[model samples]
Target: MSVLIKTVGFSLGLTLVFTGVANMLPQVEGDAPVDVKVDLSALTMDDFVAMGEDLFNNKGTCTLCHKPAPLGRAPDVQGTNMVAITTERLADERYQGKATDAASYILESMLEPSAYVVAGWGKKGSDDAESPMPAVDKPPIQLSDIEVDAIIAYLQAKDGNEVTVALPSPDAAAEVAKSDAAPGGAGAAPAPAASGEEGLAKYTCTACHALDSDDTLVGPGLGSVGARLSEGEIRQSIIDPNAVIAEGFPAAMPGDFAEKMTVRELEMIVKLLAEKKQ
Candidate 1:
């Protein structure tokens, strides 16, 4: 009888231990830590307004494109100066059509700059005709944690006193960097070089153009380009686009100065393209 009792006790103890272990396991699926997933039911409007100011001016450098009207270098808040502009934009029928609130719209703008361009903002003939805003999510200028939170706070405050969706803090920025460096992350593997003649295969020139040499895609291609243009000509063609515009190619190819691209990278790419045989 004592042995039976001991066995039962041991089984109960093991079950409790397993239960404890299960409880200790980390949450595997859901929004990322940096991802703004928490409910902002407790925050206040004053908090967000302060945050927005920081983001607009120095934090995320949002003013660079929006060209604040008063400032001219940043986006101008037309309603009640900068403080009230957030709410005004939130109420504006145009932006609100798709976004749930001012805060969400602001956050989305930072995350996906290409999704919706403010009307009449983009270059006359460019793909982003609706908005000319440069993508802020790209490299070399990642936003800090405090900056994201400040921007989020500013937008939430504009909506007549509501819960401010506080973004993760600066400490979170380090985590973002680590995640990006991890395998398969955005900064993971360098792209493979693709031969232009093989047809645009997604990663290579295809990103900016179509496959056929003559067929117009985002940029012109190699049908007779190899035979006609010398290596120097091709290299010059890219570095100094205004130097020559192919018969049908648009003159708008953005030039990459030595300031933007290394000499080695430019030379290698130019050489590879120049060597392509018809």
Candidate 2:
């Protein structure tokens, strides 16, 4: 009896120690929880891009719902051109600092989708407007304002013409600081754009193209497309998709849908694609 009691005690202590050790090791794979410690202020463009990629691929888990468009919508990473969808609309001066860019708009769309309902895309027959992107502002997925800023910067860079971002000038920063102190200063992030141009990819574009920054899928990744095509070229590509087929890519983009899609929708989709950048 004495030997058996000693053996049990040893086993219990060893088990506790093993569990504690496992918890202490920095993020283990598979079963381990992620330990993100990104310092936004110190991050370079590369770092920001990496973090944005991480958010898109892993942590924020955007792929789960807003997948690339080709396969089909929802529950699949099919045809979504998220990069283009995010850029063109954010470029509008009206978006300044408030869903002003693709990243911010995506963040806003992620956190609050109901504020601006995308026409024809709102949840059918719902009481209040319902957004498809789930709310991720709670607990583990909670995003800090600075992190949100980094994400916006990253996406903007991805969509901008492969050029270095013009960092906010000191004067702009000072104005921002002043605004932060004012009433409702830089208040809660604005709701995402319900404008058809901004909302198209989220609703239908992804149904045919992938929207990721680093990879290709049903459709090619639109990383630096902006650098290669003019607005007119992009417009023509959309209205007459078969006119210029991207090498190694199928011209399988549904052309017969010209009748199904309005000219405005075609223009918006084309313009969005023209904005991709690495």
Candidate 3:
């Protein structure tokens, strides 16, 4: 019995050491959360355009598919003059949309992506008729109306064209910011996801990574991810995706989840994914 007690004590000590070491690691991934609150006082064209640029690269997730060839699945917004392209698109017989000007074209193109599928940018096997781009005002990439307009303003300004899109009224913009704002700030933020399933739906992870079944989407199957990756690894993939690109997929996961997910919400989904061992 003395020998058994000694072994038990040693095992308990080892358990405490492992627990302490785990707690010593960083809690939040990357830096402190970037407060995306829009400055209501600074509603100038410059500010709005800057916000648009930020969204285009960050929240908007446009670069995922809009990269230059041969990787780009969408039209390269940077390489080609989008303003000029909009002009030609409006004139094209294939143009089924209602936007007659650049600002409208950009807005319409985002919300009504299928209205004008750029010649070769359509979804595969659709004969250039279907677009893979989701509406910016909709799920997973829910940019508010003001946010969408901000993108148009940015694009126009970036192309050296006049910013014809109207700046959002302070009151109107504030309402939008308020609804999505976290506790402290009145900046634009994603609608909250209260549960693990809600988070998966909000971010639409199942669109690419499967929750169950071998029938995965575009990205690799994540059905048995926990059996494969540790909880820490799953958390890292969500927060700092590019840190370790999953073997067969591009470094295409968004790098801004650290900002989007609340700590509890993040842990909820992480726990859910970590249990996906089947």
Candidate 4:
């Protein structure tokens, strides 16, 4: 009877030890979390506004298109009341978006940019009906929803207008990052374009320059640039943009394409932009 009691006590002790070990191990309830999965909810509006500024300049690449007027490929909000103009945009005969207010108009503009192309800023051949700007949620400049709202908030606050966008939540941030990261997310730039159209879209050239058409954009019409500048001159223009400002246009071409573009990308873009005269 004493042997039996000893054996039972030993078994119970082993079971307790195994239970303790299991408890000490890290407990993963489901799938592994993304490395960048972060709770953005705690970030204050002021912080997001500042973050928006940085993103607008860098990560979001908004400055690449939205510069001072008569210079930017897109409408330059500089010194312009984006909020006041938004109301006008909503009331325009051409306005087709579902937004009922300023904040939503800005957000919708970023998401479904084709919904209301600003006059004279549409893609070539779209008759001022289709914007050339890519949806900010897509590749090349995939600003997360929170980041987009931050930009709206910043823009609104910048113009002394009321910010109406809701703050981000932990789940929303985590989910967006996780989803966008799944398939070559915001961090990945597309490979060098294989064709002229691809190159044009990839580099956002059509935003400012008319490539195959006479449509007036922010930059000089490149439809016949080859009739003017040599191939080497075209290369120089891209790499050292500010060196030779085109007459009647602001020196607004981004000067950092030398750093941002790969050799293959540069070559393809140059090939497309510099068609030698026959």
Candidate 5:
């Protein structure tokens, strides 16, 4: 009986020790990836261009790799004219794919990135050169066709080039909305905002704008925006950014904030930014 008691006590002590160790260790949690969906039916050509500019600067992550200035990793978008580049590339014997025009060339670049690997950017010594650029329609980016159209429009308009594609009608967008409501649809509802910081992170505001410093990243620093612009102007900037762009910054603020942000979330962000006068 004494032996049995000793064995049971030893087992209990071991179990307690294991439980304590488990509690002391850090807990790691994995979150499922969120799908982003935007309804573009109601947006006009101007709206699309604006949204595209936002995606380019933020969600699209284009600026992370491509820059206006010449860099070793990726091509410079600002210095070169895309229309002229596309026309010239079509005449190249090394060029592959069915892109016949400037618009198609841009579309092909996004869709089939590996089709034409730009010189010096491709994988070295491989029989078929591979491009570092991932397909924008695939994972990590997963931009919708409407979003793609908007980005293309942005690229065209930014250089003062002619916009070749027309935006879809509102009725067509309504049809898309209806289809999305059906079983196994691609569309997802907007994410809930827990706080102003979460809302800013959700829309990827930190990717371009900085709160801590006056130095610009992609957009103007918001460190002193509260001192500069009124609350109403700040609110307008969130929804309609191009209305008044800050000096020394490109008018590339995303125009989809009105659709992406809830009224409460927008107010929360605006209030937080308004407090950043210093």
Candidate 6:
């Protein structure tokens, strides 16, 4: 009986130690919640544009993926003339929304990013059928409706296009607030899954490259990156994106992925990407 008790105690100690070690390890996957609010009443078009520019650079995280010039990872916001294209998309057979003009079209893009993906940037395996862009109003980068409006205004004004949406009055803003506070009012959408391949989607990698095919989106299709680069090279590319920019691609990849990814998370992604081969 004494020997049996000692064995059980030892097993319990080992279990506790293993549990502690597991807890101490860094987490490689999970979703972080975001709670954001913004009020756009009583601001001028200039104010909206200014606020929009700030948000784009900082809060919106737009500059992380988008650039003024065409980068293989994402679209060039400036070079593409987003405002003008928004208006043009209205006549496109792929545009399924009721946006009659540029402002509404831009808003639709923000709210329903997958509705109309730009060519060469769609999800893989679908023949340019789906968009990889996350809804701006969704999690990980949740922007309120008014904030979205400001971004549109900024995109328009910066590109020398006409800003169509006027700022709301204080009374109108108050009414919007009331509606939001009411039952069944504005609420956050479901957060994206944060593990495995879904984790890649959560990070919006599909925005630029496909995982399973060689079809180039904005960046080189990562279908067979392992065949071309070593594991160390793959990790380096994520940590120091410009270290070895692939040929025929701009060195516009964001350099902050190292700060955003955990060591284990980096390993997972590298392993997945390495499996791709011609």
lDDT value for model 3: 0.71
Q: Estimate TM-scores for all models.
A: 0.39, 0.38, 0.66, 0.62, 0.50, 0.55
User: On residues 5-124, what C-alpha lDDT tens digit does candidate 6 reach at each position?
Assistant: 553454345445545323333332222323234464556789889878877776676776776544434577746677677766777787777777878877877788667777776655
Model 4 C-alpha lDDT per residue in residues 1-278, reported as the tens digit of each score: 35434534543454455453223222211121112333577777777677666667766778877878766667886556888998889988999889898888888988999899888778767798877676888765667777898888888888777778877876687677676676435444333455666756656666567676544565777877887787767877877888788777677787756554444445567776777343
TM-score ranking of the models: 3, 4, 6, 5, 1, 2
Q: Write candidate 3's Cα lDDT for 109-162 as tens digits.
A: 899888888897665556767666777787677778888988888888987889
After TM-score superposition, the amount by which residue 57's alpha carbon in candidate 2 deviates from its true location, in angstroms, is 0.9
Query: Candidate 4 overall Cα lDDT vs. reference?
Result: 0.68
Model 5 lDDT tens row, 69-136: 44323687645688878877888888978898988998998999779877766533433366656678
| Candidate whose lDDT is highest | 3
Backbone clash total for model 4 is 0
Candidate 1: where is the Cα deviation over 4 Å?
Answer: 1-93, 100-102, 122-174, 180-234, 241-256, 271-278
Give the range of the ten consecutive residues with the poorest summed lDDT in model 5: 24-33
Ranking by lDDT: 3, 4, 5, 6, 2, 1
- Candidate-wise lDDT, in order: 0.47, 0.47, 0.71, 0.68, 0.68, 0.65
Q: Which window of 10 residues has the lowest lDDT sum in candidate 6?
A: 26-35
Q: Quick one: best TM-score, which candidate? A: 3
**Candidate 3 lDDT trough over 10 residues, lowest sum:** 24-33
Per-residue C-alpha lDDT of model 1 across residues 173-262, encoded as one tens digit per residue: 566556556643432232222333321221124323322454443356555566778886876776577878777544545443322332
How many pairs collide in each candidate, listed in order? 14, 24, 2, 0, 0, 4
Worst 10-residue lDDT window for candidate 4 reads 26-35
Root-mean-square deviation of candidate 1: 18.8
